[model samples]
Structure formats: C-alpha cells, structure tokens
Target: GENVGLHLPTLSVQEGDNSIINCAYSNSASDYFIWYKQESGKGPQFIIDIRSNMDKRQGQRVTVLLNKTVKHLSLQIAATQPGDSAVYFCAENIMEGGSNYKLTFGKGTLLTVNP
Candidate 1:
C-alpha cells in the first residue's frame, strides 16, 4: 500500500513562508507523477507534472522533485499565503499491459495558511 495517509491532519503556516509536502508510492512501476492542489470543497487543480524520464521539474513558484531510488516524491511551494491553504495530493499513473492508465492517489496533506 503506497497510499499516503497523513499522520498530522493539519499544518499551519504564516503567509510568505514556504511549504513542503511529502508522499510515498507503493508501486515501483509507476512512471508518471502529478501534484494537485485543492481549495476548500473544490476539485483538485493540476499544479505540475513530471515523467519518470526526469528527476525534477519546476513550475511557477512550485517545484516537484522525484527520487526513484527510494520511491519518494515531494512538492515544494514558495511563499505561503491564506489563499495557499488547501489539500495537496500526489498521484501516479501506472501503465499496465493495455493502453489504459490507472491513477492511484495519496490521501492528502492539509496545509493551513495563517494571515
């Protein structure tokens, strides 16, 4: 079971700080990785994506680092804000024998922003 279940349900941070979210994957065969951000009662929004061919990818104010040696993934967010408070999830898509891609999602990391 590579699902991410948070030991700490909430994290409080001040605005203008940075945040780091961690996740663990169960399947080693997964090739694609994605990190999503979700607001209160809203659907997850795509933040950034990285393929297995690479080790790290960066986006505007966000960075995703992947370590294939340990099957671990992380999301680094710069500048925390009240609007930045949300749940983050790491997802991986596994390509099986067929053309279909199955995505398995981690539980989530809840980030609370303090003004």
Candidate 2:
C-alpha cells in the first residue's frame, strides 16, 4: 500500500503562542478541505474545514485558509498549548465522477509545544 500521509516536519512553539501549519494540495479539482489533529495513539480528529467556494473559515481557536489559485492550504492555531502538541494534517476531497469522490491527505507535521 502506498503511503498517503507519512512525513513529520517539527514545529516548536511556546505555550500561549500562535502556531501556523502549512500544507500544499496537489489536486486543483478538490472542492472540500479539512484539517485533522492526531495525538499519539489516537486517530486523526476533525478540527476545521473550508469549502472551495470560501476563502477562509474559523472554529474556536483554529482558522483554516484556502487558496484555490495556488492550491494551498494552511491552519492557524491561536494560543498553542502542550495539549495542542500532535500531528496535524490537511485532507482534500477530490471528486472523480458523479457521487464518487476520493480524499487526499497531506504529509503530517509534528507540532511541539513547550512550556
């Protein structure tokens, strides 16, 4: 099986500081986008999402931005904490045909928050 999500770029931040995670999507046809947080021994959890029609979306302390022109995506975390330490990822939904779509994920990045 091919690995769709397997890379770790380390980001070190202090508690109460802002953390930004970047992801570049390969498919321009992707319409839906989602950010996921995966703690050790746990599965990826949905953090936030934005549609292709929208430029940005916010949820709680997190914000998701999409640039369709460049096929780029980013996640911003406000007041990064130790609890926020995890592997963060972005997934894009690419529709192949009517009612059938495939989800592609970016390489996961490790976010480390220090006190």
Candidate 3:
C-alpha cells in the first residue's frame, strides 16, 4: 500500500531529565487529539489527549499541549527514564457530514534515553 503520515526523525534525552516532543497537525477541522508511545516491537500505547476546545491536559508524569491556532501539539514527559525511550505519535480525529469521520496519525518521533 501507499505510504501515509509524518513524524520527527529522532529525539535524545538523558535519564531523569524531562523530555519534550512536538507534533504538527494539518487538519484544522480536527476536534480530538491523542498522544501515543510505542516501544520497540510493541504496539502504540495511549498516553494523553486533549480536545480542540482545550489548550492543555496533564497526566501522572506527562502533559499534552494543544495550540489550535497554529495546529501544533506537544507532549512533555517528566523524569525521563530508559523505559520512556520509545517512539511517540500524535493522532487527530475529525468528524465530517455527521457520521463521516477519520483518524489520522503522525509519523512518530523516536525518543532515545541516555544514562
């Protein structure tokens, strides 16, 4: 199949440090957003999400910021760890024509943890 999506090439961080990952979305019509983390050889796992009406949302050690005006989204991870090393993705969901909706995902950013 033809390829689709986009992502950052890589990111490097030190253990116990904070890591910030960024993503740019293309669709202004999107109303929902989600951030996901995927370890090697594993499926993408949900981290946090923010609605288009909101600007920021926080989790245990993670935070998601949405800038609808710029169509930009960012994820911040506190206390970076070896286990936190993984690929992160941002996905957007948009609804159209009442029942017609689609979900699109970013290419993903590779986060490397250094001791």
Candidate 4:
C-alpha cells in the first residue's frame, strides 16, 4: 500500500499463504500493463499482462488486476514459497503512436516469503 504517496517497497508474507503487491501509475494514456519477476543476473521474467480492454487476467498461480479509474495495478500470488522471494515490478505500456509504444516501469517491491 502507498502511504502519503510513498510506496511500501517491501512485502513480507508467510509461505503457503497468498501475497498481494500493489502499484500506482501516473499515466492515463497507458495502453497495457505487465508484471515481471526479476531473475538473478538476468532480466525480469514476464509473468502476466492485462490489456486496457480488460480489467483482470489470470495466469498459472498469479493474477493481475487493473483499476483504470484509480490507475492502479496489483499482482496476487498464491501459495507463496521461499523461492518466490524476489523483487517484482509493474510495467506500463505507453502508446506514443500507432504501432509505437514504450514501456515505463514502476518501482519494484521486494517480496519476502517467510517459511
């Protein structure tokens, strides 16, 4: 959750439970969004994405929810595990023009799954 415009930045969750991470974007012209899991010494792994036409989309053990009214996005992870401990990030796809867009990443939140 954001407190006074400050992001929580870190989230701690117990293993076998669910974890929810939230993010807020500043652009209203964003056309799409994505959730990614950062890999060690590698680029972030794509998890899920939702188009502007859709508000919710589900992936294997995760879900992405978009609140256009508030320009908010969230990722829900089920059955949190120690391996799930990593920094997650949300990216917004801004459409600059036809067939041309750029990705703007929001701040990352470090999720710690406690065993």
Segments of candidate 4 deviating more than 4 angstroms: 1-8, 97-99
lDDT of 3 at 105: 91
Highest-TM-score candidate: 2
Task: Give the per-residue lDDT digits (tens) of candidate 3, residues 1-115.
Answer: 0121124578898899999999999989999999998887778899999999999999999999999999999999999999998888999998878889898999888898999
Q: Which stretches of candidate 1 lie over 4 Å from their true place?
A: 1-8
Query: All candidates' TM-scores?
Result: 0.88, 0.91, 0.90, 0.88
Q: For residue 11, what is the lDDT in candidate 3?
A: 86
Each model's lDDT: 0.86, 0.89, 0.89, 0.87
Candidate 2: Cα lDDT at 39: 82
Per-residue error for 25 in candidate 4, Å, reads 1.0
TM-score of candidate 3 on Cα atoms, chains taken together: 0.90
Evaluated at residue 70, the lDDT of candidate 1 is 96
Candidate 4 global lDDT: 0.87
State each model's C-alpha RMSD to the native. 4.2, 3.1, 3.4, 4.9
> What is candidate 1's CA lDDT for residue 36?
88
Cα deviation of 112 in candidate 2 (Å)? 0.2
Per-residue CA lDDT of model 2 for 24-45, tens digit only, reads: 9989989999999988878789
